[model samples]
Target chain A: MSAQPTVTHKKRVACVLAQFDTAADVIHAAEKVRDAGYQSWDTHTPFPIHGMDKAMGLSDSRVGWIVLGGALTGLSVAFVMMWWMNGVDYPTVVGGKPPFTTPSMVPVLFELTVLFSSFAAVFGMLGLNKLPRHHHPVFESERFRKASDDKFFISVEAEDPKFNADKVRALFEGVHATFVEVLEVLEEEVEA
Target chain B: MAYYAPLAALDEAHLVAPGSTLAEVTEDIASVTERTAPRGWWIVFLGALSLLGIFGGTVGYLFYRGIGVWGNASPTYWAWDITNFVWWVGIGHAGTLISAVLFLFRQKWRTAINRFAEAMTIFAVICALIFPGLHVGRPWVLHWMFPLPNQMAIWPNFKSPLLWDLFAVGTYFTVSTMFWFVGLIPDLATLRDRSTNKWRQRIYGFLALGWRGSNRHWQNYERAYMILAALSTPLVLSVHSVVSFDFATSVIPGWHTTIFPPYFVAGAVFSGFAMVMTLLLITRTVFKLHRVVLMRHLELMNKIMLLTGTLVGYAYAMEFFIAWYSGNEYERYVFVNRAFGPYAWAYWTMVSCNVLSPQVFWFKKLRRNIPLMFVVSILINIGMWFERFVIIVTSLHRDFLPSAWGMFSPTVMDVTTYLGTMGVFFTLFLLFIRWLPAVAISEVKGTMPQADPHFHGHSERSHSEHDAHESAVGGDLVPEGAE
Candidate 1:
């Protein structure tokens, strides 16, 4: 009768995530979680929740800086390549146009700039988000899979400095989460 | 209250269908790909495959012989090859227009058709690239188009519009495929989660790139999508303009016109829309996707056809007027000969089909008539091919020296090759429909009223208040039990 050893071994509670039906509820829960001084938390939804950045206290994304960097690199590369190739290397004047004609060079310059910037935008976004990750503690919850479908969820991780399991569970309850769960990171999954 | 009634009703009508849920949208669109191919699909697939076989045979034979097997000769060296090249490339433009330009403009209706159009853009560009590849005859040396250093120390003419074409089309294909794939990620996730089969799940799961639809990911995705769309807008416009430069940069009278860029762009959009309409009409019927591809969508496309068709007509008229007004004898001669020369039949056919045929769309009844729209779409496709034929063949046939003039007629190879490419286009298109989500599921889901968190009771409230109210009433807090 010693509480049946509630578990045979110690279990790691990764995060306490709650499901909310509407975008507003998740936004509200997010605001409450933010106000509660939780640093490691996130909301998952089927689409981009408008103004959720403000709710989560996030600053503007760093993706634009990356894209701009790429664009400038592309422009420079095009300029140097065209200058070196046509102007210096194999300077054959055709149609009476100058070998290093700026006008003729614009199309390639513009095209390469766009190509590089686009590559940067896509890969940069993926890198910033840390995507292609097959496993997350949040995914351990069967109910959490609905995040990509009709449900919205806010997950406050155990890694948060202020994370106290009981307090976080109560916090979700206070926000009237329809379903609340504490995700566990299994030993095997962690090892794998 | 009375004043708000109509606005509310309009908003209600904009919902995909009254009372359609997010789950229903996902199920309806995904189920088409999940299910077995229907009888019509097999029929069309076989027909397209047969045509693809013809294409393969024609290409093999052409390779065995040479460029001499076709109708290309001195002065008219650029015949059906260049014509089909321009035609296919032009058809690809409409896809970019619908996806990038309309997205920037915030036309939500584009969500319904953008996926289909973008796929068309990719496929059309593939068919287009083939012509330029084969036209070199010695396909092995086609790499010479690139500015790579060679043993001969010969570099491609950087100033040549043909070189510009290589870069334009190469960039267009890469950017378009990236745009289409990025847009497909979320929808692929939906399909992956919904699939019951293990292999299907694994494949889609891999393509989804472990997307969990986290708000963080959505934020980055939305920003990336916006950036790509902005990038693609200029790219699309530049692609056709560069294609026009292919001719305009040359000294050929009909080809060397300042108005070619805008005229070519408009004609590209016109023909692209016509091709989209034809495909969509057949698609909606075959797949029973009328609810998704609505009559409203069809009518809107028809109107675009009408608008762009008029722009093209005006360009044709201006070309003639400018030729006459400028008193450039060569330009005037080209224009007059185009209308009343050896190819007068082809030229007038272009006029009637492109300019006159679209006028019927001014009447809403005709625009909405599915059969009439289909026929008109086909007619426009034919007209556009003829338009390219008129531009390339007519202009090249009788150049500055009438002594070098010759009437160009296609050999069986030319006809089969063109037909073979059509076979190639349709074959790929059919396969695409069978395998992929024809309509973008996640995007179309966003168009529904239920997509908004604060949307309730046919009205919207401030976010904070709505959140407070939703949390207070916790019973409705979970959506229909997670699927």
Candidate 2:
């Protein structure tokens, strides 16, 4: 089982996706799987499960850093744009005030900072999550579709070092999953 | 454990109705969109569409003619146009307050209403945007508001508050739309999964961006939501403040006051809440969402209206007191003239509607009375509009040069145009409710007792034992039943 197979196949087992009727069941299974040292596994639910982050052992998201970076960039851009436009590029004195007053520039500067930070926060989240994905192997399992509605699910990927189909099936059964399914990667999906 | 019981008891009052399962919540909320539109919806939509038609015609005629089409004159350049702009923008603020501010404060009641409020904010801003664009007269050259390179090489006057309004309103619309969309993602995914029709599934699936609701995705999503909420809280405050600057930065006596920022913000909240109440009342009745919207929610909103209304009334009095105390003849004249001058009818109407009407909520009976609250909300809406009208028209109609002062009156065009925006607002809003989950199903589910991992009677261990077991496991994952 440890040896690499040479034969080319159109499909391969990606993971065993189990469906649970309750969050506690899924969380319990996730803890068991984590204890068993499955690295490339994930749980899914309709909403964020409280303390699932610890169960899954995911670190804090990096989207905030992206937002901060975008905000600083925005501030810099605003300063440069205001300085270059009003002060250097085409200078004009209005209301007997200097061309570039800090008080007046603050609103635009603040608006731009928020604008950029928001964009960064949203797009960075999507990018980090690798979303807009048209297909995934888990979608092959009809039972897994309930992940977005009422059911709770856990999918342990084939890529995990300790992945053994027989053992994974036993583990899911031991945890009393309502349903368990094996997802298969299609030939076209691999080509795409 | 003894101390924790009270808190747990407090949370048991269902945010969602008791006996609601996750599947039921999804079905209940999503079914509204999946089903046929109600008769009431069609009636409202048709009325709004006709009004939108009137708005289109009025604007078209204005563009063909000139700014002279409206009642705007030499002295009263800012009349109904600016008034409507300020009023609509102010109404948009409550949505952000509910979604971002209340979320940050952990006010769970907001979940039922925030989605609708956010939708209203987006729609209201669209209506508000129409005013500035058209008010510029040349509407075609509205791009001049932006700092773009032109053949003339002229940059917009960045020092001007009008320029600030551009940035403020622009950023506001963008961030509000983004915040609303991001919050919609998970809900949209739920809708997608529930959808049986292939086309419906495909469309909702595409909009859902293939969301799987994976734990990792939810972790990132919650973090991003928190950051957006934090960003939006200040953004909401600043947008209205910048709008206040549009008036305050002016040398006009009534306009140039430091109190305008907070005063305007309070007034915005007051008006926005009233509008939310007005819409939600109709919505709950039509959709039969009483269980979700709840009497508690409506009463809470009324209380907010009472508080903010009082603040607005106080501001009205403060403006007068300050005007009198400052000893500035121009300032004092503007205040007195607003109350007792040519537009005094409008001013008094504002005072009665905004200040006097909401005071009825001081009685608990009145607060819970839906019909009474509905009427008061409508009155407040009308009153807030008059508040803007009084501020803009009265001050501009009587400037320093009494010789140049003129009494401004609206044209047929102005009246229709204003009414038309209402048409536009409702048309968009009607569509929103018909297609989307007006109450957030997923969010409300999160507020349920079942959502908690250690929820009593569901978990095998006692709450304290569960906590101890979690801590004992620490960074390491414990096997099932390890404790």
Candidate 3:
């Protein structure tokens, strides 16, 4: 009889990390990892650890563009409101200046634009990033409590195709990492 | 940078005896024995409460009587009342700016001062709101600023900056309160766990809202805080800008200007920083928090004052330049009047105090000299108030027609209102210091050297350094599941 037909599943992924002595060392390692054709690698640090952005091959944040859009919309809204309300709705000739003028509306318009744009920048970023909802996989480990206080970590998400628990563990060990552990995903308790 | 020091080693309490753990630091903060509240504190609290009572009594009287008792007469329709309003609002700006804008810039030193500064901002705004709210004779009709489907049938004039002020100040107060409460949550939890009395524990527990410091909670907390910080930074800028528009949108020669928004914002921050310095100096001495507050923090605040002061100075020069360059006769007269006219003493007082006094901050010794810095900060506050008085009263006292020219003087109520506001400000501040942890414990804890595993050396060295560069290589080696 022929051998039974075999099936393979390819959805899970794992990340391997090595310990470095400095932020510069981590960046250097990240660059090497990037060059080696890994697309789903990231690094975590206790603090900001400047220049890590370059190591990760990330682009400039789009937050500013979002702010600009918000500001412009805010500016336009302020200008339109002032112009329509004062010039058209309740026109008054104060200090002999023309009612349908730009200068009178400029201050309110400028203030409002800045106001709206900043609001948009903040709320937009939060919504886009899906933040503050408070769900993450890292809480399952007790040692993770130190994430903000001292420890640095690398998380290769499960969506990454290169993930394999045994293979990733071997890679991390080869790099002389101080520790390695498989992240276990538990079934969430049903609310019923 | 080589100058970087880990902040962890400094955590050892010089006040508390050695061999204390992290939990004990919380205990020291919540200690409420007879020894903790010295006799002097009772005297101070009583003094503050008396001033607050005077303030409350004056407001109550003003409400019962008419607004006519104050010195807001013709020609100078806005006298000490508006001047104090502007001054208090200006003083409030720096707290949120320091906490939120500096946070975004990753200025780590802000952790030491942000908590008290934010509290100052809230109290200052409360003082500010009183004057404008009661300025109109009908105090109950203050809600006219809002849109309502009522018998009055009055839709607020959207074009008016006064109406905009309602929205701007209200937004600022709401957002600042939210940001402040969000920050207080974790600290409240710490207080809850440490309280000896059951009532104190229950009250703090409710305020804490059941925070457990779980990873998920921390994650969410951080995200919400960053968003709030981002919100507050811009709100700070906008509130003052809207306030500036109250004058800028007008056609009065000195009041009208395109650059007023940025100019006012800079001046607000300048005065705000000075007021912060004034409060911190006294609070540090009273509470014996010199180590936590540090001379470095004072120096950093002085640097901010210098920077903002320069911007304000530039704004002063720009106002004159715009007047001359625009070739407008009235605008030129307003500029000339502010300098060489009847109120020139007030004008020059504004210049020397706001412009020149801050120059002393350039000297590191002067900046670190607590007593000298305290005096300069108080003088700056005085000068800033006079600056507003000169701007509001001088410009309006003599307008386009000399025939309408007049002088203004404050009645006793005006004087009392100003004093009462200070009383209210100090009362809240004193209560805050007594009841809560003045320093941000979580933020300070976050800056510890041992918190950075890359830190290698004596903990003392790391404790003093605000910025330390440790290797990120070790940071990345944290086990995936662990993080």
Q: How high is the CA lDDT of each candidate model?
A: 0.85, 0.87, 0.68
**Interface root mean square deviation per prediction:** 6.2, 4.5, 8.0
lDDT of 1 by residue, B209-301 (tens): 888877777777888888999999999999999999999988898999999999999999999999999999888889888667778888889
Considering only chain B, report the TM-score of model 2: 0.93
Query: Isolated chain A: TM-score per model?
Result: 0.91, 0.91, 0.76
Is 1 or 3 the stronger prediction by lDDT? 1
Q: Estimate each model's TM-score.
A: 0.92, 0.94, 0.71
Q: Please write out the lDDT profile of model 1 over residues A1-192, one tens digit for every residue.
A: 334333334468899989886665677788888889999888887767666777788877788889999899989998898888888988888877888888888888888999999999889988988978777888788786677677789998888999998999899888758799988886532211
DockQ of each: 0.37, 0.49, 0.05
lDDT of 1: 0.85
Candidate RMSDs in order = 5.7, 4.8, 9.2
Sorted into a CAPRI-style docking class, model 2 comes out as medium
Model 3 lDDT per residue over B1-483, tens place: 111233334333222222323333444444422126666567878888888888888888898888887988889888898899889999999999988998887677777788888999999999999889878678787766665545754344555678778778876776676677767766775665556578976777677665434322344345556666876777788899888888988899889988988988998998999999988887777766654677778888998888888788888898899999999998898889889988899989888988898999898888888888888898789889888998898889888998988888889989888998999998888888788777665565444443333444333222222224333223343422233
Error of 2 at B403 (Å): 0.7
lDDT of 3 at A105: 57
